[model samples]
Target: MSLLSVLRAELAFGMTPLLDMASISVLEGERIGFIGRNGSGKSSLLAAMAGRLALDGGEVRRRDGLRVVLVEQEPALPLAASLRASLAARGGLRAADLEGDDWRSTARLQEFLQRFDLDGAIDPQQCSGGERKRAALALAFASQADILLLDEPTNHLDLDGIETLENLLIDEQRGQRAAIIITHDRRFLDRVATRIIELDRGALQSYPGNFAAYESRKALAMQSEALERRRFDRFWTQEEAWIRKGVEARRTRNEGRVRRLERLRAQREQRRERLGSVSMGVAPGERSGRMVAELEGVSKSFGVRAIVRDLSLRLMRGDRLALIGPNGAGKSTLLKLILGQIAPDAGTVRGGTRREIAFFDQQREALDPDKTLIETISPGSDWIEIGSSRKHVIAYLGEFLFPPRRTEAPVRTLSGGERNRLLLARLFARPANLLVLDEPTNDLDMETLELLEATLADYEGTLLLVSHDRRFLDNLATQCLVAEGNGLWKEYVGGYSDWLRQRAPPPRAEPTAAAEQDGEDGAGRQARPLAQRAAKLGFNERRELESLPGLIASLEQELAAMQERMARADYHRQGPEQIRSDRARSQQIEVLLEEKLRRWVELDARRPA
Candidate 1:
């Protein structure tokens, strides 16, 4: 049964058309992942479906008495109200109603707040961005709504928060509730979405299953579409040549052919070309000394809280390092210490010679909102130098997906993603041997994010990154410096996934009183599990470690085969029970593989030096 339908939706922004004869029917139990380029009116579409915005033409139909809730990109909460009161108002619960015997509503509210680690009595305005987002989500989930419209729900969330959301949505799919979510988190979509819907050129294209399935089908469809367009153009060109013939040939032209040619001309005029990918490149500066920075027994603290203690690290040239941790984990403080921007309390910080640095701050304080795009990139002069090449400011902005007309527009007029792109455009124009980016993937589209990844992979200079995006870290980081709580940092050999497999689980008991005393004195205690696992493996443990590789490989093979089957165009045509069983088995394999990998790492770490 269809819960909602958008019938021939026609919407426009001023003179530009955002949606043209677009239509889609959202059915029951459907978790749809909505994807598109930045500024493609995805948010507007969600608003229209939720009945918050009226369409210029066409209509939105909803099932009778169906409740729908929308979580905006920047959710607003009453400034004067506490978090609990804000959520209660959203659920339409008055003071008397909450005080009555409504156990279910009260339980639901407590469940979400506890799951999100939010204190209900706190002021909404005092919460951080991620906390605010969680509160908004909690409000939506506690409602009686059957459908949810989420816009960039993962923007400020950390890795753990993203996983929590994924699990919630997957559980929700088992119920009758449905959702239409707009996000750029690829891994989240892979784990949660039951279907994928793309908004391209003001039209909706539906594909069955997750993001991987859509990627495969979209590639083949684009190829076929391109071939057909080429053939059409060829025929159109022949008709144009015949119509341009001299007077004698024109008189002999068939009347039917002439009418058909006129129709083709109109079709060509109305065609909307697809936008191109972002073209990005880095300009390398003069080579620097091999060593970038080195820290010797560094310790930094703020008031009574220790941020970094007894930490030593050497950063070399050409190293791509990622700093991974939750928000407020001292990642920024560590980065500043490495860059020699601040003095350490009790250690030495050394800088490399001949190093030129370019930093992309997450706050984007470098961009002036009052300045035009042209002025921001190249003030006064129209031409800017990129390494050895010189290009006009307008053309440079074009490479970053900004149109010529918007070149003179102020920076404040651009959206969040656009502002990030503009920052990249400015960041890349300068020559630097060291690049430091803080949360660079926060608001980027998938296409732009992938392009940025590729560009960074090809860079010859050193890179120091801080981000909560697991996939981005997995793709680019050569090593990760993870926060191990209490100002202790550990270095993992690979990216975020590697850290997950190698990290020691939390201690089962509280630290000894002596250990706690030492921690308070700036000496953080290592977890007991690491010490317990340091001994040599026994015979049974050795045998188990030896068998892990074969078992892991077999499980991987099985999972790959299942994925290949699921990616087939006719995969959804199978019996519903069979599809469910296969999906269940695939998930089981993933869990088994993670366990095997963790065991292997643990045993290997126990081996003799």
Candidate 2:
């Protein structure tokens, strides 16, 4: 039997049709991803399936004795209840009801909490945003529902938390349990989705395979449609010319036919025009100086506790920096200091003169929840009235995957991912020479995230980003700044993977005379001053470390040579075996070049003044 099925479902919110004759069947162990633009009825359809929103027509069916659970974008856990109490209230295994009288339920809850890196559950009332979401997810997992519905499950989850959720879903899939996940996270969809179902115009359409397949299909469909339109246009032009050139009697006889043809052409044109493009425009700005921001001896302290200390760094133009560390490790504090939002206890913080800056904070608190989407997009406009600007609003929201009808909806009514997309839509609508983004990808869908990444990759500004999304950082960041223990900050000159390699504790150092002389044979070796080693290294070692420029130039030469060889191999009419060998050789060269590039990064990191 099917785990769940919706047949000819029809639902509406007041005058708006939320779902119109939408039919879908989900079987046991099937993992489906529900995708659509903001306000595209994804949530409404989920609600209808869960029996929270009554269907106007048709019916929903489920297997006998099957339990269903729905998790919303903004998880609704009772804030006043303790974590343990909340879990117990959710009808899960209780501590007192567990066999062996071992507090197994409590232990399980603790295990999940620790797995998500959440701290002690003192007064769940005061839990952080991320913590609350984690707690809610834990309750859902503990409930052991047969059919699980997750809406934007990755919202507010860090990279580690997202990975944990992915692993949980994979485990469930392996166990033959079914799930329907509504998310904009492309990476998550790529990892977990077995199939994708898009909710468009209150109708459901299933795409076989994963999110990537859906995208490829959509692109191909659009291209085919474009080709068909061009063909129709050519035919229509010829027909119109023939009609205009015809004798008077012939024209009179064919007037009705021409009118009918005109109507058909108009209908086709309308259909073609309905597939709107994602348009985005950034205002022109003056180029920033080589150094966008600089910090020297910077320290921030709250009362007696230090958050950041003695941090010194320089942000150059075109530098894309990712700030990473554990929660509450002062990543945000460091950003605030850079933005001058808070004064440092001691140090010099400088930014390039005349540099224009834009920031997208973690919470996106800059957006007013009470405001309508149209109002948010064009605030205090005299010429473009709220209702009159529907076309403009639709055009603008299209870029962020929001529909025209959602422009008048209150921001408060939008989902987490919707709000995040709106904030980004607004951010990109403007232009700046420097951008400071904190967790920009938190609530965005995979498609939107890819668009944002593409936009940023082409952005000609300095970027200081704080994100837990490894893929986002790997794709966009050219440098990394880690907020480490004891208010310390370390900067690496490469991307996330490069930073990880550098951070891997340097291979155990061999015992030396200095180690024995300083009585630092074992534990004391770690205590040895790094300054002493720097002092001991000779000028040649320093020069070797500083040879990054030369190495980079040499790598560039090798890369160019490899490209030339690949081009020759492609153009030459060699046998299939020789062609295959050439391709393999080219790939080997590319791999070597990548390794050398990483080595250049390491050398750059060790450069002396």
Best by lDDT: 1
Model number with the top TM-score: 1
Q: Return the TM-score for each candidate structure.
A: 0.84, 0.70
Q: Residue 97 in candidate 2 has what lDDT?
A: 54
Q: lDDT per prediction?
A: 0.86, 0.72
Window of ten residues with lowest summed lDDT in model 1: 520-529
Query: Which runs of model 1 end up more than 4 angstroms from their true locations?
Result: 95-103, 246-253, 506-609
Q: lDDT tens string, model 1, 290-399?
A: 99999999999999888998899989999989998777889999999999999999999999999999999998999999999999999999999999999999999999
Q: Write the per-residue lDDT of candidate 2 for residues 440-501, one digit (tens) a residue.
A: 87766555676687678778888899887776786689989886678888988787767877
